[model samples]
Structures are given as structure tokens and as C-alpha cells.
Target: MDANSFLMGGGGAPTAKFPTPGTVVGGHITEPPQVEQQRDIQSGEKKFWNDGNPMMQLVVTVQTDQRDPAIDEDDGKRRIFVKGQMKNAVADAVRAASAKGLEVGGILRVRYTHDGEQKQRGYSAPKQYEAHYTPAAAAQLQNQPAATAPAAPPAQAYGQVPPGVNPVTGEISAQAPAGLDPQQYAAAQQNPNTAALLHQVPPQPGPQAGGEPPF
Candidate 1:
């Protein structure tokens, strides 16, 4: 079949395969089918910051301001994109730059130029932990003990104990032990399952320099 559209001076391109789920057809008017396999991804991480040093991996989709899908000439292969870079990028440490107004879309940037040089642009999404966070944070969060402070001392008969305090506090307060636990956290991270689940980054086999995943 052939569908004609009055856009970009009008052209009747070849027909597209039946639309799939999560696939938008035109003007944010997503075809009803765009609801299948995409269910598992909660705010899919189209943009991801991998094992440190500012590199990023991302998924992307695109459309014109008129909301027309960029259908390819041949297989109707419209390239969806999630913009990324490792310069003095907003998310210097990771893709979480958007939360702090970092990374263009909080996770990724979307753009197209005259001749692909960015003559046009806009934000695509938030700095999703799912997308823009460093794999390190994932490895770290599992073992890092949820960003807590040192376990406060007992209710000093004299001084007032801090909040989140318990009756008798142990020496190893939630404040992670410097030498051992951090190392253990580092080690636990590279365990394939843990790495995949926590940070969305994979763990590499063989030996690493400091037990860390090069993150």
C-alpha cells in the first residue's frame, strides 16, 4: 500500500510495515500498537552512562516538529536517536545530569541539523537513573547502604542524640567502613547478576585492577 503525506513539500513514500508497539506514527499520535514489548521498561534508559570516564550508550527515536515520523525511503527505517557525548557534558560524572539541569534531557539530548549539524533541537527526557546514571552508582547503591550518615552515638545523658538514632548504636554505624565494606561493595558489583540488576551495566569477567568494574 501507499500513503501520501503533505509534508516537507510532499512526497508519496513506500508503505510501512504494520506499526509495532511503542512506535509513534505521527504528531505524537502513536499507533495503538505501541504498547506491547515496551511494558517492561519503566522510562526506558535510551541514554546510559556506562563504566565511567564519560562514555554513554543510548536508544533514540525521532520525528519532525509537525509530529511526522521520519519514515525511511527503503525499509522505512527511521532512525530514532538518544543524543550523548563525553565532553564537558552536563552529566560530567554520569547521565544523571538532567536532575541538576545536566544532560540535555536529564538523560539524553535530541537534535538534527541542516545536513545533520543540529539546526534543530529539543530535550527528549529526564536524567533517568535508568538511563543517565553511571553503572558505578548501580554497583555502589546496592552496597553503598543508601547514602546514610554515621550512626549517631547513644542518647548521651548529657548531649541529645541525633535523629534516625536508636537506643544503643553499634560501632559500624550505617556509615560504611572505609577499608573493608567499600572493597566488598566493589567486589559484589562485578558479580554479573548484581551488575545487571543494580546499574544496568554488565560485569566483566577475568581480573580487574581494583576490583571495580572500571566504572
Candidate 2:
């Protein structure tokens, strides 16, 4: 191994641990969401659902607030594993930000609100969360000089455009991007910001509906 690599802080951020209920994590997202296959811990095999569909998770890394003791990292970096209801929470947060999906430098805060109703007797109740997101541009505006801040763009009406199309050019694509489903493609086209976000990140399988826990 190269000795210089050690000085460069090569290892990635440690996964953020939710030690208890009501824990809150807030930070600026450092990268786009990463989609990875879910694996069984003991068997070390990829996980699948009852219908034979593969399970997946979205990984998001954030530069956390140093004061948040729950993170417990000197570097204030933490990785969040999002699945099931957590995925929906994060996606909803992103949508509320009025930009796209999770974007680099976006502000994200999530709280472990409570446990959900247990669906099965043996399995634990799913962990529920509340998330909020602020777009990078919007966050930066707070610090920008008033005279230098750019004017906001006018909103465009996209309701008439077909799914998987560009409203400005009125161009429709013949097929969805690789890995995106029809529903996702339709949603992406409906919102230009979402389409831009989709272009930046590779398409991944949609989250599965269940009581899977968030880590």
C-alpha cells in the first residue's frame, strides 16, 4: 500500500448509527444518492422479496454538524442507509426542496420519529423518520450578497407535455433511461428539476413497500 494514501484520509465515512428513538441527524449532503443491493447480514447473500424482486437501498453521505454527538465522528461525516419508508421520506424531502432528488451540498435533516405498526409478529416494527431538505442554491443564497444574488427563474407550466419529455423543446424520448421504470420516468419528466437529478445519478430500482428498517 502507498504510505501517502494513509495521510489522505482514504477510508470512507462511518455509517451513521441511530442508537435510539428520537435521534436527529442534520448535515449537508456531500454526494448524490447511491443505490446498492441489499444483502443478508449472516448469509452474505443478496436479498430478494417474496415476488423474486431484488431488495435495494439508497446510500447518502453527509457532512454532519460537529455538535451532533450522535454522529460521534471527528470528521463529522456519516453515511445514511435509506430504504422502505425512509426512502419515501427522503424523496419527499427532496421534492419539498423544490429542486431535484438529493443533490450534492443540499441540506438534509432526518429524525427518527418513532416506530411504525408491526406488520408481522416475529419481525420488529419499522423505524419511521421525518426528513427535510434544502437545495444547495437556496442554502447558498443566505450567504450571498443581496446585490450579487441572481434573480429567480420564472416558472414554466409543464402540464401539457407528455411523460419522459422536455417541456422547453417539447421533445419526447422514445425510451426511458436505463434502470428507470415507467412511473419514475413520468415523474421525472413532469418536473425538470427531477429530470436533471435523474440525469446526474444512474437510475435504480424503486424502493420496495414493507416494514424494512432504516439505518
Candidate 3:
């Protein structure tokens, strides 16, 4: 089996649970939120609400503060399964952060505030939640990594000259350079020994690097 398939054999991160009111969990979102249909625990079948609509839950995986020893092992990751009012609260928080939607690297905090009113007998009241969000930039500032010196450019290979320079004479080539394509070679031939042909390639930005949580 491939590495990914082998890793998938292990169970996912533990689901964050709110045992009682006033429970709070705060962390950085590790990935985009996922919407999945709810399933029955006993039958393992898809579930629906009373109105016959499919029941769905928003799953958000977070790299949480290491405050809870029970589930903070390994990578300190937790999966939050949100539905009902909790989903709405999370959406509002994301909007308050000026984000179009929940995104990876954003900060999120959720609180189990209280229980909703119970309308029928023999039924439990629904749990209610509140949430807040901080954009990635703001969160980075709060837990900024130490600044490091910029890296120097890599040295060119020996005997490997730049496009416009001749290797033997170490001067501008009067003809098209060795590595140019047909089009570029044609253009170079038309403008040989000109400073305009000696273009300096711009440096490209590398992928954004992720930092370890200060938690």
C-alpha cells in the first residue's frame, strides 16, 4: 500500500467534545471546513431532520492549544463536528474576520455557552455555542516566528555561462546563446551584442511556509 493509504488505516483525529456548558476550545484551522451528511450511530445510515431535509454537519480540523491532555497528543489536532446553532455561530465568526469562508491557517475559538429551551417532554434541550475568528495575518502577528537572515542566491555551475555571455571569451555573444529556443534565438540574433538582450531573470516567490503552533 502507498504511504497515504497506510496512514489512512489509522483513525482520524479525536472529535472535540463539549461535556458541559462554558466549555471552550480555541485553535488555528488546519484545513478548509467540510460539510458532510449526518449518519445514524446505530444503523450507520444517512440521517434527516424532522422536516425531511438531509442533516448535515460542518467538520473543522484545528491545531489546538495544548490545554487538554486527553486529546492533545501527537500533533495537537482536533476535529470539531458542528451542527445547528454552532454552525451558524462559526459562520458568523468567519465573516467577522472579513473572510469569505473558513480557510486553513485562520484562528477560531468556540464556546459552549448554554442549552436551548426544550419544547417537548421526554426530550433534551439543544446545546448552543458561540464562536470567534481571527484572520491568518493577525494570528501570525500574535505568534510571529523569529526573523532570520535572507538566504543568498545559489552559485552558478562552473563553465555554465549566462544566456548573453560567451563562456570562452567571458563577453557578450555576437550570436544567439546556446540554450535559447528557436523564437528566442531568432530574437537574440536580431538584437545581438545589445544590453537590452541581457535580461536578468526575476526571482520567484516560494511556497508560504507553515509555522509550529506556540501552544
Candidate 4:
């Protein structure tokens, strides 16, 4: 029978066969773990399938320089699926590397085990799996410089007023000279010696009229 006949007769659907369990792969971490939301391709809907899942992912580039013909010929990179529990492993690796963490050139080893079958429709690979990371002793691992701390800015002391400025918010205000008492300072601010007088009233002509006109 044809492909459709076989499927209708309960033979099986076509699926991509993956490597068996207990396969080991070695590679350098080309991409660090980043938390990203999983979304549907067609409908653009978020997919949260796993319990206690963070939806983080990483990528590994297979070491082709090890002279392995299989890896050298085939595609050298693969995307790793990360879950909440697996996030711990990634954290440990990063902590071990210190400043470098899981940066681009860090080396790692992974062991493959059967994860489960994918139930999503129109997915070619039904029998999906995941990778388990381990510290690898490779020459490519290098230490990165530790991040430097930022310098602290100078702060003004409380209640210490600056020259001709308010102490609280650094605004302009009238100020008395140094070593002056509080009451003296207030008096000096209220009454200044060099203030200019605008206008003056002259004494009226004393009793100009004989009948005291409009005193």
C-alpha cells in the first residue's frame, strides 16, 4: 500500500529517528543561557507546557577541531532545551567560570537521554530529548576580567550651609557672614545697612493760611 494507506491501516506515522540514549557529545558553549518566552509559530500564542519551567535555552557548538570526522562533516551546532531543574546546572557552570561564566568560548560536555515524545501537531521530531551539562577540561576555557565597581559621588553634610546657599536643597538664599549668632544672622538678613531709600515726603508749609486752611 501507499503512505496514506499504511497510515490509515494503523501502521505508524512518519517520524525522524534520533540517536539512542547514553550518547555523549562534547562542545563549547557558543550561546549563554537566556530566559525567553516560548511562543507558537502560526498563532503567536505563549506555550507553557512544563511544570516549574523557566523556558530558558542555550546553544552548543560541537568541537570540530578534535579531528572527529563525524562532527567535522555534520552540522556542528545544536540548540539545547532548558527547564527549571536544568537551570541549576547552568548556574553551577557559570559560577565555576566566575567572571567568564558560560561565555561564548567556554567548553562543556553533555550526555543525552530519552526525554519523551512531543505531542504537538505538524512537528517532525516526535521523540525529543535534552542535554545534561558537565564541566569539561578543555584548553579553550579562559578567565574574563571581573567587573569593576563604580565610584561613589561626594555628598554634602547635613545642616552645613554652603556660601550664600540653603543647606537643605542647595538653593540660593540670603546668608550672614561666618561666626555670627542665629538671632544676629536673622536681624542682618531682615535689615541691611546699604539698602537704598526710594522716596521721601517733605514737611508741609506750616499753617500757610491765617484761618488754618485745610490742616
> Relative to the unseen true structure, what is the C-alpha lDDT of residue 95 in candidate 4, on a scale of 0 to 100?
64
Off by over 4 Å in 3: 1-7, 50-52, 66-74, 145-215
How do the residues 73-186 of candidate 2 rate in per-residue lDDT, one tens digit apiece? 468878888889988998899877787677787888888999999999999899999899988888778667778767645334425555556656645443566667665676
Q: Write the per-residue lDDT of candidate 1 for residues 97-124, one digit (tens) a residue.
A: 3233222112222222112134335833
How should the candidates be ordered by TM-score, best one leading? 3, 2, 4, 1
Sequence-dependent TM-score of model 2:
0.57
**Global fold similarity of model 1 (TM-score):** 0.16
| Decoy 3 TM-score against native | 0.59
Give, for candidate 3, the lowest lDDT window spanning 10 residues.
198-207
Q: Against the hidden reference, what TM-scores do the models get?
A: 0.16, 0.57, 0.59, 0.33
| Candidate lDDT values, in order | 0.31, 0.75, 0.73, 0.45
Alpha carbon deviation, residue 184, candidate 1 (Å): 52
lDDT, candidate 3, 54-159, per-residue tens: 9999888888765465544557777888888898999899888888877788888899999999978997899999999988878889897778989744323442
lDDT of 4 at 129: 35
Per-residue C-alpha lDDT of model 4 across residues 14-122, encoded as one tens digit per residue: 2112366665555665544344565565896766656955444433344422333544344455444444434455566556655444545556554545555556778
Comparison by TM-score, 2 against 3, better one? 3
Task: Give me the overall lDDT of model 4.
Answer: 0.45
Best by lDDT: 2
> Cα lDDT of model 3 overall?
0.73
